[model samples]
Target: MVFYALGSKFIQEKKDRENTPPKAQEVIYYSLAIGHHLGVIDCLKPQITCKVAEYDAWIAQLPIDGEARRKLEGVKRFGEINIDGTHTHLLAVALHHSLPQMTEQQQQWSRELIALLQRMENEPAIYLLVRRHDDW
Candidate 1:
């Protein structure tokens, strides 16, 4: 479900890039990365052993610079040690970048995504699932 939402946003961002300013495009890229990280946390399953591979595929498709790439690499590393904390930090950074320029609808979606992240943060089962995998 989260993945679907992320995919939709990614498509929209791609389409919007033509009209978007360079700085705003950077925000969009960060937002996509944050969304992907959240999607990974949401999609974790005990039977799945290829989560890191999935993440790598997604990362490879992103058109980000070295700094953004490093930030995402940090997301993967920190997620292994602390999924909730890492997600919170990444989401906050993405939001800070994107919020000032977002349309009302975009802001609403961001709010919903933030709520979802908060809910997931409180789920111990999700944390355990994250810890069970080191492939990331």
Candidate 2:
């Protein structure tokens, strides 16, 4: 189980380093897988980050392809994306950079992962819209 988690991170990092457009999408997916394995979906929450708008703006800058963008669309909850077909890595990166304050139940390993990523300067812009991409 632990190795699975580590493997996910390794794959994510490898993709991130590639920094190509398609590779960015791959990084987003693999990172989310790692995030899910690490239980980040359960740890971060709607109320944690006051800067959802900022985070959303940052995410918007990434050249997310149509499929990945569509995957990220139509979500009402942060955790929902984990099961709703949105890329997990993108979700994890969003939570990490958003600096959301977690609930008591969520203050655990996930938080540590977010903090660690943040420490590594993995900052990106985020986009928050009232509706979906249509609202943008």
Candidate 3:
């Protein structure tokens, strides 16, 4: 899961560098989505870094090809896993990042969401399920 997140971040950076859009649109989309999931994980486990730089270095060695991109697209489309409340989790992270200036109500909501995420992250089964990615 950590590797997927780091790889996705690397891919997003690669895509951002190109002036033209990536030929594999689905790959880019799924990369960003997975990266977002990583962000949520980071929020839950603030102390965990997962050697992201090492993962990025390893990901740089991989070749991006049509077949791989198609597989990623298929995983994104056909994978049965459903992640609920991701939007709310994202919103909480966003609000937390925007702290100090955020309204009291927003801050309270962010704290509540973070608490809920912490609980979810503590569940061994949920953690195992979320960490599994068929595309990898």
Candidate 4:
């Protein structure tokens, strides 16, 4: 009789556990959709652009779990994509402005960026490819 009650209770608890949803991971991928949209040229210009510092500060402020924090640190080691004003400006223009809004040259730049992102998605590892390509 006692064994039957215990077995039923265990089954009920198992069902409850199975019904519960898993916790969400805290680290979010920074993207244009999330308002992390930084300009390539703007990022490139360190002297004039505080975006990298600002982003770092923002990340520090988030209340993330230890796993997410570790992942973010890994991401930070890659450094800001822009060390010069030129790349920062180019990235910014590509992400924020429409082709119609840009001059012909800038439109071409946007097309290149779109292609790059698509290619990156298909590649097995973006960081590995980028590091190798950059000789970093």
Top TM-score hit: 1
User: Where does model 4 exceed 4 Å of error?
Assistant: 1-97, 127-136
RMSD of each: 17.2, 13.5, 17.4, 20.7
Give me the runs in candidate 1 sitting further than 4 Å from their true place.
1-85, 127-136
Predictions in order: lDDT: 0.45, 0.38, 0.36, 0.31
Q: lDDT per residue, candidate 3, 2-105, as tens digits?
A: 21112223333444647535555556545444544465444222211223333233223223443322321332354322333333344345445544654554
lDDT comparing candidate 3 with the true structure: 0.36
What does candidate 2 score on TM? 0.24
Measured against the true structure, the TM-scores of the candidates, in listed sequence, are: 0.32, 0.24, 0.26, 0.26
Error of 3 at 42 (Å): 31
Best lDDT among the predictions, by candidate number: 1
| Rank order (by lDDT, best first) | 1, 2, 3, 4
Of candidate 3, the 10-residue stretch with the lowest lDDT total is: 123-132
**TM-score of model 3 (CA atoms):** 0.26
Give the backbone clash total of model 1: 0
Which residue pairs clash in candidate 3? none
Clashes (candidate 2): 15
Candidate with the larger TM-score of 2 and 4: 4
Q: What is candidate 1's lDDT per residue for 39-128, written digit by digit as tens?
A: 554433332233565545433432355333354455366554323435654654564465555656445645654564565565312221
